[model samples]
Target: MNSQARLLDKLCANIAPGKLEWIGLRSERRGEVVVIDQAEAVVGLGLVGDHRMKKTPGSARQVTLISSEYIEAICRHTGHSSIDPRLLRRNLMISGMNMNLLRYQRLQIGDVILETNALCHPCSRMDEALGKGGTAAMFGYGGLCAKVIQGGAFSVGDAVIRLPVIDSQERLFP
Candidate 1:
């Protein structure tokens, strides 16, 4: 099997959906992942917005960050606004995976193991944050909300790993 298929199959074995959409990045300044809810998340702060909180909701969206490619693609198509990574507020930005196919997949980027908790629904705050009506464009395309089962330092350039692959009979597939 190809590397991509190997990875996808591995992910499917661990969680219900075995796929990954993107990965995120943040400096050490921002506190590690604290809470991961379907709608929103929380990151512990030594001092709120003192210096490390990249933005208001630094850790709110973990695991999923907007990739440079996605930003470039959207901007190329819209030709109206350029997406600033700062405004994205995601930990890892990515491209390639069909976001719609991420259900029940076990995604492990770096040392952080995550399971897709739930779909990230849109809200008014998104509109205010991304500019008027921008939320509508992003309605179906925001990163996922994942619960981190393991705690570890995740830096940029880390490779994402999926669970080992298993066939229909629940046996490891060659």
Candidate 2:
């Protein structure tokens, strides 16, 4: 293998494992976010009561996750003091891991298992939530979108474990 491929593999393997730091669900699209201590993740759907629980045909964005560090980075870049996890509109806020490395891999949070689908690109709504340059500040730091593969209960403080990646020709970025 080439040096770049080896470096990528090494980086992926060394990502610091993270934990579920917070959970938030919006009952309706663009609704106020409700913080929850625990939630039931349903396979093929998403966290119970979340606005995005209903899967759209041909869509892989069943659940959204953001890194707490990423939030801090956005705040620093945007000159904001701090940005609440809920304001980011992602279902779960995680800490420690580089979520971008989990693409094409399975993640275990408590009893639930989720398959990483793709990067959850920042949307225009960011501008509404974070003001002015929110969308651009979150570029490349939006986090991951995943699909629940195993249904179970998960809660704040649960460890986020990245499972072995499935072998496929479909690279995370190509």
Candidate 3:
């Protein structure tokens, strides 16, 4: 196999299945986040009721996800006894998986299918929500942004499965 093929195989081998631990959404930017047991992932938009749900043409960030493990790490790094996941402003809080590995991959959360868009970059709001040094604490562990491909309902306990990645060129040309 070629080097590119080997790299792709390695990435596939690292796929980690996890579970959604929490969900939060806000009606407006900087608005209060409301915890929900379930949410509707709308295709081309985002989780229903979320302030950032509106689909922007050519924009890749539709939904955001963060790892519960990263949250704990942030708490320890910032010297906080505990930090609420809702304050992170991410649409979903998942656990038992390495979220970074999901980049450039497709995932299925319950019935909704999502394509990883990019790493979610933390903004100044992190400092406001997580206290001082919050933005710096979340530097690389902020999580990921994804585009909703198939709309469906997903609950807090839904399983997060990393789907196999298929090369589109191979599929189209074969």
Best-performing candidate as measured by TM-score: 3
Give lDDT tens digits, candidate 3, residues 32-142.
Answer: 999999999888888888878763533568888999898988998788888898888888999988876677667899999988868898999989988899999999989
Model 3 weakest lDDT span, ten residues long: 165-174
Q: How far is candidate 2 from the true structure (C-alpha RMSD, Å)?
A: 2.8
For model 3, how many clashes? Answer: 0
> Per-residue alpha-carbon lDDT of model 1 for 1-174, expressed as tens digits?
556656655555443322223333344543333222111122332112223334433242344544455566545544546776545555555454444445334455555555543555545655655667656656556656554445444434444554443344232113
Which regions of candidate 1 fall more than 4 Å away from where they truly are?
A: 1-78, 165-174
Give lDDT for model 1. Answer: 0.46
lDDT of 2 at 58: 31
Could you list the CA RMSD of all candidates, in the order they appear? 9.7, 2.8, 3.4
What are the lDDT scores of the predictions, listed in order?
A: 0.46, 0.83, 0.83
Give the TM-score of each candidate.
Answer: 0.53, 0.86, 0.89
In model 2, how large is the Cα lDDT of residue 12? 76
What number of clashing residue pairs does each candidate have, in the order they appear?
A: 15, 0, 0
Of 2 and 3, the candidate ranking higher by TM-score: 3
lDDT (Cα, 0-100) at 13 in candidate 2: 71
Q: TM-score order of candidates, best first?
A: 3, 2, 1
